[model samples]
Target: MEEDFVLMKGNEALAEAAIRAGADGYFGYPITPQSEVMEYLTAAKPWERTGMVVLQAESEVSAINMLYGGAGAGKRVMTSSSSPGISLMQEGISYIAGAELPVVVANVVRGGPGLGTIQPSQSDYFQATKGGGHGDYHLLVLAPSSVQEMADFMPLAFDLAFKYRNPVMILSDGAIGQMMEKVKFQPQRPRMKDEELPGWATTGKTPDRERNIITSLDLDPYRQERFNRKLIEKYQKMKEEEVRFETFQCEDAEYLFVAYGTSSRICQKSVQLAREKGIKAGLFRPITLFPFPEKQVGALADQVKGMLSVEMSAGQMVEDVRLATNGKVPVEHYGRMGGVIPTPDEIVEVLIQKFIGG
Candidate 1:
């Protein structure tokens, strides 16, 4: 455990932490907001110190395929991109999911329907937690609200990816990705030795064992269905065991604000402002957006008069919040889109208008 603290931007911390977490390779193209991830890694020269393989792929599509190759070899691999780039990688992402490959992907999201803006936004929530590509698959989505979490979740993302043998995404945004904060990194871990590769990995097989094959294609329909079922079961297990969230001033509250990533930070301040104005308000921040602390949100629904889902997008996560509440209370969405972040005062005003005004 290294307790030494250092100032670092979110993207830089993420890159450094991946290296420290024993990631064997990173393949990605340059994308705003997250480009620093590769930039920092290249400048840090992890290849010299840890023999980590860092390569700048020609495009997002190429980068994700490179990740597939590295992961197939049983190497800890990762990539980072912004909105448009992530969209370009969707096909490869779907294939990786179908093959049940363990890989870490960081989406430092920006506003986008298509190359919308380079600034931060949470609009990618749907594409992230839901099946972005063509498949009945899910990525373990971790939403980091701070620069510190941007660093901390790197190892955790890789851990979960390998633990479930599936893709894990760190769903951040421009705010967290570019912001600077004090971070204390964990000590570096040694990379997995070639001999330690899983038996299922595509390492050269011995005469005693069968060859390892990694493929998303199964022509047989029944076999493919079985594979899909297995993947669903794994997702259910993740939901049951890995749902994570943070609560602020929820006890005995009459109103609740649900948010994640950068939006949650703004909501926290709004909660304080509401309290000052004699409104009983609390905030629920979903740390794991995929598993999505549904049970907790449902429980909160029983106590609160109304709940508001806040985001830097057009009401994406609000749907999940509604599903969690199950119509138990009046749940509404408030957001600012196109790389615009809502202010705490704005959130407080919305809360008052929707839940408090007669």
Candidate 2:
């Protein structure tokens, strides 16, 4: 099948890809850095073309609940927001996780602690990988570094969300969301047939099957514990089967740079710069931040002298790098906060000052 390639912003590409991937509904509130997601969907009028449902919700809370309702009915539904907005949806996300519903959420992350800035940042690393809500639940987190992956991961996120019966997140930063790049869209697929939905989906009961109900509330402590344990087991299986990362020039490297999302793209250029300066530097980019590719990072720790974790946050993912390395090698973090992005040269300088020269 032929693919359609076009120059598009990451958020717009994601919106288009969802329709092409047969998304049944998109319910979202407009927010900077990611407002284009809903804007594109509304303007393109997917409802007229593919009969997809598009609604501008009153707030982030309402939008996420709408996602839960659509997902409960076994429809491929998604919502997108920036950092503060995503924070508002945490409760709903947790409830969805508890009820074992499938929904795709995209966070076009911006700098934050409280209404920080509209520019790019990766401060939400902890929020996305760790539980942002009240529970032991984990989101299947995919970090996209480019506009292409921003579009590409939409189908993959929905596929994984349904396959594991869990919530999935596309953890993108504002830079990637706003940047223009060439994206190739997959051919459109039809939405799932009504009968093809899982038996657990709340699509009205049939005479031959039990009634389908969706709820996160378990009054009994024992039953809630069991449910939580089941969720843990599922997470373990995901770690075993879904860890994804890309290694660049790692074969003979003495120093490594670990990053994800936009930082990873900058790290790639830093690696090239380091190589020109006669420093054997490689980069490890984690595509799936939740499954984390810990095993791969651990293996590289044995080969490299040290590693530097580059991020737009103060130092979130560096903790994961240290854990993966098991403290066997020195790992340090360098970052710019509140919407400022560190340059490749700045990263290289940190590599020299912290890991190499010192």
TM-score of each: 0.98, 0.98
Q: What does the lDDT read for residue 37 in candidate 2?
A: 97
Off by over 4 Å in 2: 1-4
Assess each prediction's global lDDT (C-alpha) against the native: 0.94, 0.94
The deviation in Å at residue 257 for candidate 1 is 0.5
Off by over 4 Å in 1: 1-3
lDDT of 2 at 328: 89
Candidate 2 C-alpha lDDT tens digits along 1-358: 3345689999999999999999999999999999999999999999898899999999999999999999999999999999999999999999999999999999999998999999999999999999889989999999999999998999999999999999999999999999999889888988888888877889787799888889999999999899889999999999999998898999999999999999999999999999999999999999999988999999998999999999999999999999999988999999999999999998999999998685
- Against the true structure, candidate 1 reaches a TM-score of 0.98
- What is candidate 1's lDDT per residue for 1-358, written digit by digit as tens? 4558888899999999999999999999998989899999999999998999999999999999999999998899999999999999999999999999999999999998899999999999999999799989999999999888988898899889999999999999999999999998888988899887777899887899988999999999999999999999999999999999999999978999999999999999999999999999999999999998999999999899999999998899999999999999999999999999999999999999998894
C-alpha root-mean-square deviation, candidate 1: 1.3
Q: What's the lDDT for candidate 2?
A: 0.94
